[model samples]
Target chain A: MKKLSKRIIVGVLTLMLLCSSLFIPTAKASVPYDSYTYNFWLDPVESPNPYVPKDEFTGDPTTMGKFNNPQDLFITKDGIIYVADTDNNRIVFLDTSFQYIGEITTFHNGDTFNKPQGIFVTEGNHIFVADTENQRIVEFDENKQFVREILRPETELITDNTSFRPTKVVIDGAGRIYTLAIGINSGIVELNPDGTFQGFTGASEVNINPISYVWRRYFATDEQKKRMELIIPTEYNNLFLDNEEFIYVTMGNVDVKDYGIDVIRRLNPSGINVIRDFGYGSPIGDYFVRDQQDITRFNDITVTDYQVYTALDGVNGKLFTYDYDGNLLYVFGSNGARQGNFKNAVSVEQYQGTLYVLDNGNNSITSFELTEYGSLVNNAIKLHYEGKYEESAENWQQVLKFNANSDMAYIGLGKVYLRNGEYKKAMDYFKLANNRKYYSKAFTFYRRQFLGDNFGLIMTSVVIIIICILGLRVYLKTKKINVQKREVNGI
Target chain B: MSTYISTLRYSLYVIFHPFDGFWDLKREKRGSLSAALTITGILILTYVIRRQYTAFLFNTNDIKELNLILEIISVLLPFLLWCISNWCLTTLADGEGTFKDIVIATSYSLTPLVIINLPLIPLSYLFNLEEASMYYFFLTLSIIWTVGLMIFSTMITHQYTMKKTLLTIVGILIGMAVMIFIGLLFTSIIQQIIGFFYIIYKEIVFRF
Candidate 1:
C-alpha cells in the first residue's frame, strides 16, 4: 500500500510538470519585432505592441488560385476586401473572413487587365481598377459590369515626355477622382466625375537652399550642371480620401532633408496642406534611423473615419499610425519572413479596427487585430476628438495601465484635468508628457490660483515691507542731521 | 576673512565704475584670486540652480539626463579657455595684463550674469508663456551687460585703444577655436597610439 501511494505521488508530480511546460510555450509566444513610439525627444520608446498578427491569407488554390504579387488592398464600408493582383492581372474579392468570393479578370467585351496595380471600392459598391501598364482607370458597377474607362488625359500640363501609368486612385465624397500615376512629379491628377481632366493639386514645392542654389547657378560648369540630377517635385506614391473629403497623400522618394515635412500631406479642397504637426515629433515613420537609406519610405496610406491614418513603410515593412494632430499612436511590424512580419509591405487598408497589409514579396495579406491596449488608446483619442474629455480621461488612464510611457495618454489626461479645473494635476501630467505648450497653459492657471489663494498674505507682506522701509528712511535722516549738528558744534 | 569679503564687495564697484575700479583692482591690490575663484564657484552654482529650479514651462532641458559634473565642466572649461586665450593674445599685443589679471577681470565682469540671472530664476516661476518676453528680455539684458563689462574690463586691464582691444578680442576667439582643435587632435592621436600598442600586444600573445 505504501509503494502504491508513493508511485501515485510521483505520477502526479510528473503530470504537473508537463502541464506547466505546455503553458510556458504559449505564454512566451511573443511577436517577432519590437513595438515602439517616439518620445518628445524623438527617441524611440519601446512599449507593448498595440497590434498582433491575427490571420494571414495566401489565397486558397482550390478557390481562386494564389495571389501573385498583389500590389494594393481596399476594404469597403461593408468590409469587402479587394486585392489588386498585379502580376495576375486581376482584382480578387474576399469577405472579411478571408474567404474568396470571386474575381474580375475580363470585363468590357473581353478586355483583360494588364497588371492592374490599384483597386478602390466606392460606397455605392462601384469598383475602380488602376490598369497600370494599360495606362487607364477602369470602373465597374456593383454587378461586376464595366462602367467606363478613363484613359490618359489630353492636357498641355501633362507634357508628352511624361508617361501616364496610374498606380493608385482615390475618389472623394463628391465623386471627384484623384489618380497617382508613375513618373508624374507634378501632383495627384484630379479628374472630374465624367472622366474629364481637372488640374493637378498638392504639388510638392522644390526647396533649394542658398548654397545649393548658388552652386547650381554660378559655380558648376555647364557639363557638370548637365550631369547633375534635375530638381523636380516628388511624385505622390499613394493617396486616401478621408471622410471629411480631404485627400491624404504619401510620397516615398522625398529628399532626405524634407523627410518629415512633405512626406505625408493632407490636401484640402483648394489643394492647401492642412495637416497639423503639433505632436512631439512630425509623423515621420522612424526618428532614430541608422542611415539616410534606412529612412522610412511610405508606400501606402489608409485613413479611418476618425481621422486616424496608418501609413505603411515599404522599406522598413512597418505600419505607423497617427491621429489627426500628427501624434504617432504606435509603430509595429518589421521586415522579416516571420508570420507577423512582412518581407515587403506594399499596401495597407483598415476595416473597423483591424488592419490588413498586402505583402507583394510574399504574395499574401496579413491582418492585425487590435489588442486591449490598442483599443484603449483608440478610445481615448476618439473621445478626446469628440470633445468628451470626462470619458476620455478614463480611457487614457486605462491606456497608462498598459503603456506607462505613452506621452499621448499623459497629454490626453492632462487636457482632461485642465478642463476640470485641476490645473496642478494637469501640470504634473503635462510634465510627464514633456509637452511644454500645454504645461505652459496649465501653469498659467495654476499660478493664478496660487496667487488668488495667498492674495491677503501677499498684500499684507507688501504693506509691511513698505512701512518698514519708510520708517528706516525717516530714522536715518534724523540721525544724519543729529550727527551734522554735533560736528558743527565741535563736540 | 575680512579682506576676502572686501575684495568680493569690490566687484560691485568694478562693474559700475570699470575704468577706475579695474585699475585699482590690479594696481591697488583690491581684488584677490580667492575672491575671483569664489565668484566663479557662485556662478556655477547659479547655473545649476537655474537649470533645476526654473519653471517647467521655461526649462527645456531633459532633467533625467542632467549630470552635475558635466554642468560644472561645461561652465569651467569655457571660462578657463577664455582666460587663457585672452591672456595669450593680450601678452603678444603689447598689453599690460597678466594671466592672473585677465582671470580676475573676467570673473569680476561676469557678476551681472549672476546678479541678473539669479533673481530671474525665481521670477520665471511667476510669469506665464504670454509674458515670457519680459523674462527673455531680462535674460538677454544680463548677457549683453556681462559682455559689455567684459570688453570694458579687458580694455582697462590691458590699457589698450578701443580698436586694438576689439582686434585682440577677435583674435582671442580664433585662438580659442584653434586650441580646441589642437586638443581634439591630440586626444585622437593618443587614442590611436594606445590602440596600436594594444593590437601589437594582442598579436604577440596570439602568435606565442
Candidate 2:
C-alpha cells in the first residue's frame, strides 16, 4: 500500500508539472503594449430630442444601438455628413454644404442589412455600417454605388467552424483598419483591405452557438436579437477616434443599461492596457462595461477641434459633449419627443460648422450650428481622491436632477458612504461602481476589493489540505508496516 | 465466429459485470482521480511533444490540422481513454475489469454511432462528394462523435444510470460551450480593440 501510494503521488505531481510546462508558455505569452485612457460621454447640447410617436410611447418595445433611427454622426473630407438612417435601412450622406447628396439603400436584400446601425467613412472614401438587420455589413463607394462587402456572415466561410458577425467598422489614418464583429465571442476582426481573417480579436475559440449568438446579441437594438446576443461584452457597437491617443467604443452587446456603461470602452492604439472607461451598464457586462455606466448608451462618435460628440439613443434621447479630460461639458435633449427631442436619436456628426442628428422614430434629421459648452465638472477621480465629498455630492445631485443614470454620482455616493462611516452604504456604492459593465484599471482595483483576494487563497489552501491528507495517509501506512515487520521479526 | 470476434465479444460482455476478478493484483483499490489524471497527463505530454518537437508532429502545417485529424481521433481517442481509464478503475480501484474487456465492451459503444450515421457515409459516395457532401460528412461525423464521446465518458466516469449520465453529459457540454463562447468573445474584443487603436498606435510610434 505504501509503495503504491508513493507511485500515485509521483504520477500526479509529474502530470501537474507536465501540464504547467506545456500550457505555461501560452499563459505567459507577453504581447507588450502601452494602453491609455480616454473620456467619452454624452454631449447633450448637440444631440437633441426624445421622439416616439405618442403611439410608440404606448407600444414600441425596448431596443438600442446603431439600429434604425440614427444615433451616430460623421462627416467626410468633402464635409458631407453621413447618417446610418438605421431604421430606414439606408445611408443618408449630406455634402459639406449640408446639401442632401441623395441616399443609398441596402435594405430588402434581406441579410444585406437587417438593421443599419453605425456608419463610417475612410480617407479613400468607403462607407461601412454596423448593419444589425442583415447580420452582415454592406459597403458603399464614394459614388454611392455597391461595393463588395469587406466582410460577411462567416458561418461556413470559416473552415474550422469559426463564426463572425461584424457590427461596426473603424478606419485609422494608416488605412489598416478593423471590424468589430460578433462571433463565437464578441470581438473585432482584423482584415487587411482584402478581407482575410489576419488574426482575431475579442473571441478566438469557436463558441457552441457562436453564429446564433452573434445574430441575436449583435444587432443594434432589436431585443429578439438582443436576447439571442445575451452573452456579455461580445458585441462591438460604435467607434470614435481623435488621432491615435484614444479610441472610444460603444460596446452594447453586454446587457448594460446603456453607455453609462458596459456599452462603451476607451482603448489605446496597441489595444493593451485599457486606459479608462466611462460607465457601468450591467453586472453581466462587468468586463465589457466601461466606467461611465449610469447615463449613456452611445453609438456614433464624431470629433472636431473644439469638442467630441457622442450620440446616446438609450431609453431616452441624449447627446453628450466632452473634452480630452473625459469631462462632460453639457448634455442635450431629454426623454420626451419634441422638435429637438429624440424618441431614439441614433446618429450624430459635425459637418463644417453644423451638427446633425438622425432620430430613428422622429424619422427626421435635425441640424445644429456648432457651439461650445464650458467644461462644468472635473473628473470624478480628481474629486474623489482629493476628498471633496460634499462638493462632489452636490455636483452629483445636480446631475441626477437631469440624468439619474450618472455613474459619477454612484462613485460620489460611494465616497461619501465611506467618509461617513456608512460602510455598508459605501460598499453598496462601491459595488455599483465595481459591478457596472465596463472598467479600466481603476474599476479593476475596486473589483479586487469587492470580490476580495480571499477566494483564491482559500482555494489554494484547500488544494494544499488535500495534498497534506494524502501525505499523512502515506506516512501512517508506512509506519504501520514498519511496526508490523519489527513485531514479526521479534516473535 | 472468428476467435478474435468471439473473444472480443465475450470480453466485452464480461466487463459489464459489477466487478472483475480476472486480472492479477496485489490488492485492489479504487482511485477516481487516477483515471481522469492519466488522461489529462497524457494530453499534456502530447502537447509538449508536439510543441517541442514540431518536426515530429507536422511536416507542413501546425494546429490548423485539428479538424481533419479529429475525424479519426474522435473514435480512437475515446477507445484509448476508455481502455486506460477502465484499466485504472478495475485494477487501481478494483473497477470491474481488464483493459481487454473494456476495449471490447466499447467496440459496441461505436454501434450507435454507426447506426446513426451509416447512411450518410454511403450517400457521400453517390453524391459528388466534393462541395456539399463533404460538408455534410464533416457535420454528421461531428454529431456522431459528440454523442458517442458523451456516452463513453460518462460510463467510464461512473456506473450511474444512463439517464443520469445523459443529463450530466449535457451539463458538461453546456459548460464547454460556455467556455468556448467566452474565449471567442475575448478574441472578438481583442480584434476590435486592436483595430480601434492600430492606426492610432502606428501614427504615434512612427508619427505617421
Candidate 3:
C-alpha cells in the first residue's frame, strides 16, 4: 500500500515536471503528449545511463566472470545464449548449462566484423550476425559455419550514416531480418528474405535512433485512415507483429553519450508511425528512495503478455518489471558492482522454458526457469512472422527439447505470444529476461497508451481508488464513533 | 404618379406657409424649386450636430458599423417619412386635417419599426454566442416585428390597443403562416413555370 502511494505521488510529480516550462532553445515547440504530430530526437545524445555493464558473469547470477564491454545479448529457444561481445569484435554463443560454444567471429572466410553489435538465430539454424563496423547483415548456416553476405552494396539500406553502427537484430516469424540501424538519423531497416531493402518505415527528422522491429500492418479503419493520413504517416514500426500493433523501442543509453532520453519510443510497422516518447511518469528529475537517486535509465526491452521488461543500465543486475497495465512489479536482482549485482546489467533474453542474461561482469551466461505469465514457452517469432499465431504456441514445447535454457528462443517465443495477444506469456518472458523494473514500468505505461481516448477507463479506476480510500476512512470513523457512544452511555 | 407630384406641391405649400414664403411661387415654379433646394442648405447645420447613436446590434465585425448606420437611417428616415407619409395620407387620401394631421399619421406609421426595434436590439446582446446566435436574435425580432407591426397597423387604422390589438395581431400572424405554407407548397410549380418561359426565350432569341 505504501508502495502504491509512492507511485501515485511520483506520477503527479512527473507530470508537473514535464509541464514545467523549461525552454528547449533549438526545439521548435509543438503540442507535447499529442504523439500524433511530433518528431523523434535526432542529432544529440543528452544523458548517460547510471548503471555500468556487467562485464563478467557465470550461470546463476550468483557468480561473476571477467569480460567487459558487453553491448547486446539474445537467447535462443533451446536456452542457448548469444552476446554481442562488442569490444572483442566477435559474437559469443553459450548453452543453457553455461557451456560455451564456438564463437563466430567471421561470416564465411572474411573478417566480417569491425564491431559486431547484434546477433540472431532463425529457423533451421540460419544465424544473422550484424557486423556494425562493416555496415551489413551476415548470414550463417545451421552448423554455425560461415555463409555469404545477404545484402551487399549496403547503399540500399544505409542511405548514409543514418544506419551506421547497427544494433540488435529482430526478425519476423517469416525469416525477414530487421536491425536498429543507429546513426545521425536512426531507423529500423527491414530486409527481404533475399536480403535487400524493404524501404524505411518513413524517414526524415521523426525517426532518430529507432531500436526495434519494423513491419507493415494497418491498425485503423479506412475512414479513420483517410482522416489522419495527412497527419500520421502511413508506414509504422510494427513492434508487435499483430496487425494492429506497435513495436516499442528503448532510446538514450548511457552506453552511448545521449542524455535527456533515458526514454522509450514506439512506432507502427511500415514506418509512418513515428511516436517518439519517454516513459510514462518520467521520474521528476530524480527520486531519492535511499541515498542513491532512483533513475529509470532504461536499456534493452522485451515485451510480454502482461508486461514489458527493460534492463536498467543503473544498479541491481536488475530487469525492471511492469504489468501490461504498466504497473511496477519488481526489480529481480541485487545491487552491487559484483556478480548478481546487476552491474551494468545490459541485456536480457528469453528462450524456451527459461530467461537468460549476459552478466557482462561475470563474463558468463545464466538462465532462469520460467513459471508464471501464461504459455510463452512454445510461441516463437516464427509463428508471428508467418502470421500463423493460432498455431504459434504449439511448436515451443518440442523445440525446448534441444536445450533446456535457450534465452533468445524463449524471448522470441515470448514476443510471438505477445503478437498473438498472449500478454501473460509476454510477461513471463520479460521476467525471465531479468527485466522486472522495466516490466513494471512499461506495464504502468500501457495505461497511458490510449489516455486521451480512454478517459472513461481512467475515471472508473480513479473513482474506484478514491472510493476504496474513502470507504476505509469512513469505517475507521464509524468504529471510533461507536466506541465514544458506549463510553458516553456509561456502559 | 401625377397625384404623387401634387402631394409634394401641397407639402411644400404647407411647410412654407407655416414658416416663411422665402421665394415667390407666383413668379415661377422654378423659383419655388430653387427656394426649396436652397432651404436644404440651412438644414446641413442640423446634420452637423453629431448624428444620433442607434440600438441595432450585430455579431460580425464586418456588419456592426453597417448595422449601426442602418439603424440610424431607419430611425431618422422613417421619422422624415413619418413627417411626409402623414402629410401625403391626410392631405391627399383622407383630406381631413392640415400639415399637423400628416405629422400625426406619419408618426403613428413609423412607431412599429422604432418602438419594437428599440427594445429588440439590446435583447440581441443577450445572445452572446458569436454568429449563429445573432440569427436567433434576428428570428426573434422578426416574430416581434411581424406581430408588432400587425398591432400598430390595426391600432393606427382602428384606434384600439391593449388586449384587442394583440389578439388581432396574433390572428394576422396565423393567417400569414398559412399563406406562407401555401406559397411554399406551390413554389416548385411556380419555379417550373418561370424556367419554362426562360428556356423558351433562350432557345428562340438568345440562341439565334
lDDT of 2 by residue, B57-172 (tens): 01122333345455446545555654554454345433444454454334433433433343444433232212444645654674675456546534553444567556655554
Please compute DockQ, using alpha carbons, for every candidate against the native two-chain complex: 0.79, 0.02, 0.01
Indicate the residue-level lDDT of B135 in model 3: 46
Select the stronger candidate by DockQ from 2 and 3: 2
What is candidate 2's lDDT per residue for A125-236, written digit by digit as tens?
Answer: 8876766555555666777666766545334444434434555667677655566654534355556665555554433222235556565556646646534433443455
Ranking by lDDT: 1, 2, 3
Residue A14, model 3: lDDT of 89
Model number with the top TM-score: 1
Could you give candidate 1's per-residue lDDT for residues B57-134 as a string of tens digits? 789888888899999988898899899999988888888999999999999999998998999999998887899999
Candidate 1 Cα deviation (angstroms), residue A194? 1.3
lDDT of 1 by residue, A213-268 (tens): 89999999999999988888777889888899899988888667765655889999
lDDT of 3 by residue, B28-133 (tens): 2212232332233222222222122221223222222345445445445534543444334334432343454333323232233333444544554333223435
Full candidate order by DockQ, most accurate first: 1, 2, 3
Per-prediction fnat: 0.85, 0.00, 0.00
Backbone clashes under 3 angstroms, per model: 0, 96, 102
User: All models: lDDT?
Assistant: 0.90, 0.49, 0.47
* lDDT head-to-head 2 vs 3, winner: 2
After superposition, the stretches of candidate 2 with alpha carbons farther than 4 Å from their true spots are A1-73, A86-89, A96-98, A106-115, A129-138, A145-147, A153-165, A182-184, A202-231, A253-263, A276-295, A305-313, A352-354, A370-491, B1-208
Worst 10 residues of 3 chain A by lDDT: A31-40
